[model samples]
Target: MATAGKDTTDASGGPGNTATPAIRHSKPPVNHHRAPRAATYSTSILPFERSPNGNILAAFCRAAYWTQGRAVWGALTASGDTKHCYKMDHARRGRAIIINNETFHHDLYLGQRTGTDRDAENMESLLSELGFDITARKNCTAAEMKSMLVEAARESQGDADCFVCVILSHGDDGAVYGTDESVKVEDLVAPIKACKSLAGKPKLFFIQACRGKFVDGGVEVVDSKGKHGQDDEEEMESDEVAVQTIPVEADFLMAYSVAQGYYSWRNREQGSWFVQAVVKVVRDNWRRMDLLTMMTRVSHKVAYDFESNVPSNRFLHMKKQIPCITSMLTKDLYFTPKV
Candidate 1:
């Protein structure tokens, strides 16, 4: 399979074309009875080549890069085999915790999160495709959010392969907002990292809240003249090595929708740019690419291709966003689907 210097069409069709989601002035009617959670749906196969010990063949991915100019598209095509993502003896099928913070009680914050519901629904579908048993919480408090994560990690026991928590809310530097107040991001992560049950497992955090109030202005770049689009499917690596446990937080990865000190964009219709971009990449390529690589593609599409078309008085320039990755992973992660 071809793995280097390939060109592909952008799967999103074109960027900056989707209408921005609108904000609602009134609160949604509180359902006296909440609906049952969406049923788990795992019908797809997304597998990539992995070392016998479940470690990824870093050498195989080392030289892969998209050409300078090309249609943005899925990194891996449908030609690849399907395997549920895996970990060595250190792990098994994992859990995904998604927190949706759409409403606030205070008038200072207009928390009518018009787009967050979509964010949660899409996240549930995406993570489920990779075999995660999902636990979704809506409109949590700073305190409640913490308790929920603790419950998630309570059974981790270093036996699960990974932990993924996605937060959608209003936020500022260093923290995300709850209905009542802001919860420092550090505090939210503290208990999860300290969970002895989750020791050595990868902890993945995807936060889709404003970091601050800045935006990105796109720059021009030259494109590569490769008129070809070829997707090199990843093949399984036969090398099996011993798998050992590592530090609990050492494999943690946090992907923020925007850079620190910047604002995140959302559509009342399409949901937040960050979450939409993330779900799209994982849905299209989870079986063929690693988490980080998929994220890089997401960052590219959201940053360079998407922009806020909403009219703003306080902000004059067209707004743009890019997802940031903070990782301390010791091994590459590949989410495989069950056959």
Candidate 2:
């Protein structure tokens, strides 16, 4: 089994410090949720100029073209092209399970995961709004977690369009902690993958936990606007479709809160940066973007918008994180609003 490591402490204690002998392993804390302060810099371009090239007409035309393109694509996808996208017209959206493990067993030596309830609450709200039937479990042991997941997988999914599992806990590379012990990430998802009823359906796993102990001291870069601005598939069909069997791993999307070998950051009063960004991005853009696209936005929000601010611990201060997405989805996934 993977060993748990020290993480951030509660609001009063410095990061990586435990009041007792047992090791506590949770996300490092960010004292605040706001962006870091930076010195203001002036840009060469005038504030009134809307376009980089200084051509109002050209900028207007480009904007119009992009809007038109998006409309066209939306129309196409809204028509339900099953060949390129998952069919989401089921009577029910899907079943969603959230496993939130906050406090751990004394023998486990893992620290209590502070603020995880916020993450769970946010996730529950988001998924519920998206039409998923939510099943929430808190502070489950490893056996209980495995049993619950297996039972969930076995539940009839014929009426459902997808499956979602969100885990908020302390973790190491490839494993997430239950209250009593660690469970392999793969083991957590294997039962779902083997669910015959959910074959060819999207199975999403959102994991908010540390993958390792490494910290990211983000690199600084000048804004391009200050320096003069600027900035920055496919399907197949077949007749006879001979005994088509989807790969056990197909349609699985695993979103990790942090890159491997790094600590994921969380706010003691709010939630993990990754989960908060996911809730915000999905709520804002799910109607217009595919799951992968929304996840990309989630990664961006977490990477650029959040940073650790543990002034009490120099090693944990100003730390950064980038979410990792592993997708084996065979088609575009859109969470179209329920009628």
Candidate 3:
């Protein structure tokens, strides 16, 4: 869910031949419990099911939609802040398919004041009611996010199971922000390991954006009780649980919000904060929780519901912003459910 500017073109869009760059070397550490594995660590766990349309699983769209090998793709803000014309709908689940390329916030840059077309229509109605399949391309090109991940890895031909991509643009170190343009997430995830039908699956990339410099503090205040609003569970036991699946050399997971340089928050109005704390902890814990404990309860509610005041500005005023999770998940992915 990270995207900002634009410019790097390829796939006939012209300009340095759509840039592929190639930065593969970096996939060797993930044991994720061996279930058609693929390496990635720091806390990765995706593989949940249930929700064919009713009974419950609606909050964030998840009917499974084909989970055989998993297949999801997102390009979100290729280089557009907003032009708007979205799409996202899913309902299969047997083989896993969720793609909601969200693109909202069309033109402004750095100063942002609300425009990305209602933040790309609320990220296409919140990942299509949490199901995802937003029809693809709200703002694309890195040759269309590498030709839609090589056509969702050739329609997951070789039994595609796991491969997710979520980029919500506006970054720095390494790069991301394409809406007029700015690319390089290693040129759109190094061509998904030369897609042999997504080679060995398990290729997740859930980044939010901002990896530069903007600090006044680290942000880590805690002190809450209940009533004001509740959703407790501050670690009863599960602290670390990355199992590792394919990455003896294949699988991959890249979840980022900050920690390269720093600074990830966008609220010209109401968006950003690691994607509203990752869709409010996956719509209040996808049935119970397990995407690394719902992204560590969205990194502890974005480190205690955010704070970086500087209102009076005597010299700099407010800044503080902390949000980081560089996990490369390998296993222990309960996939959240079981309530």
Candidate 4:
């Protein structure tokens, strides 16, 4: 239980005079082998054959198919074709602002977000790889967060493809926390949406926080193939976009870590499940998948690949989460990977 250092005022002097907490730079080792209370479900294993050249033929075939399919799709949705998909061929991929609120003021009564630094780090890395200039902040107050977003919106984005803002904090249904107070999620988006330079460009927001306090005790589903084995060892494996808007709200995508009235779980060492899933999914499939499709995979990964492992609290143990995605865009949005 390491305590955060004393807070200091933001140098930008935009708003909220409250002191910001010192950011924790220590990286804890991730625990990936935690035992589950119940037997884990396993995924089906696919058989593979090796070619005469010692290559995995199935893998090579799959790769080839993926590449060829994307090439065709890319041709169909060529640049300047806003009818089928948004153009992602600008000189810049645009800017990303990551406001990570890890520690709260003592008066706020909120516990520190133990693993959020990892989330911020991963998000920054992923967005940078996607060619967005990154502006990251830690432990901002509500006013400071709002001020930053407003300032970001004021910047010139005429040559950029899109805008992205990622907030990692404790939150309720429609808002997220700052160091001192909570800020409306809509307020965070309004500034960016109203920016004239980004009018037709995509605006993406990824919020990783608890939407509420309710825990989801997942329902059991019977497998169609047969009954599952009782032994723990036997049950081990398994696993958008658009835009257009002449409309004010069009072309914006809001991705929430959990559904309204549900808690979003985080590993004290590994960060939030939703952020991890988003980073991995985007990194793996951005070259071919649309933003919405990648987000759907993110939702599936968070919903099925993670479960709360709180052993001491029966009410919290084995809880589940499902991410919520709200899209207002009118066209398919893909992140055409940079050369």
Among the numbered candidates, top TM-score falls to: 4
Q: Deviation in angstroms for 46 in model 2? A: 45
Provide TM-scores for the models.
0.65, 0.72, 0.29, 0.73
Error of 1 at 192 (Å): 1.2
Please list the residue runs of candidate 1 whose C-alpha ends up more than 4 Å from where it truly belongs after superposition.
Answer: 1-92, 223-249, 311-317
lDDT of each: 0.59, 0.70, 0.43, 0.69
Candidate 4: minimum summed lDDT over ten consecutive residues — where?
A: 233-242
Candidate 2: regions farther than 4 A off: 1-7, 10-74, 77-82, 224-248
Clashes of each: 21, 2, 87, 9
Task: Give the best candidate by lDDT.
Answer: 2
Ranked by lDDT, the better of candidates 3 and 4 is 4
lDDT of 3 at 38: 30
lDDT minimum window of 10 residues, candidate 1: 233-242
> Model 4 over residues 146-237: C-alpha lDDT tens digits?
98899889999998999999999877777788877777787777789789999888999898876766778877766312122111111000
lDDT of 1 by residue, 1-339 (tens): 111121111122211212222322222122233333333654222121232323223312321322210111223224332122235333355777888876665532343556568888888877765667677777777788888787776774566767888898877667787666667787778778878866766789999887765555545558512121123211110111122212325878888888867767666555777888898888777655678888898887776556544232224234456677887776667664332
TM-score of 4: 0.73
In terms of lDDT, model 4 sits at 0.69
lDDT tens digits by residue: candidate 2, 200-260: 9999999998777678888776641111101100000000111211233789999999887
TM-score computed on alpha carbons, candidate 1 = 0.65
C-alpha RMSD between model 3 and the true structure: 19.3
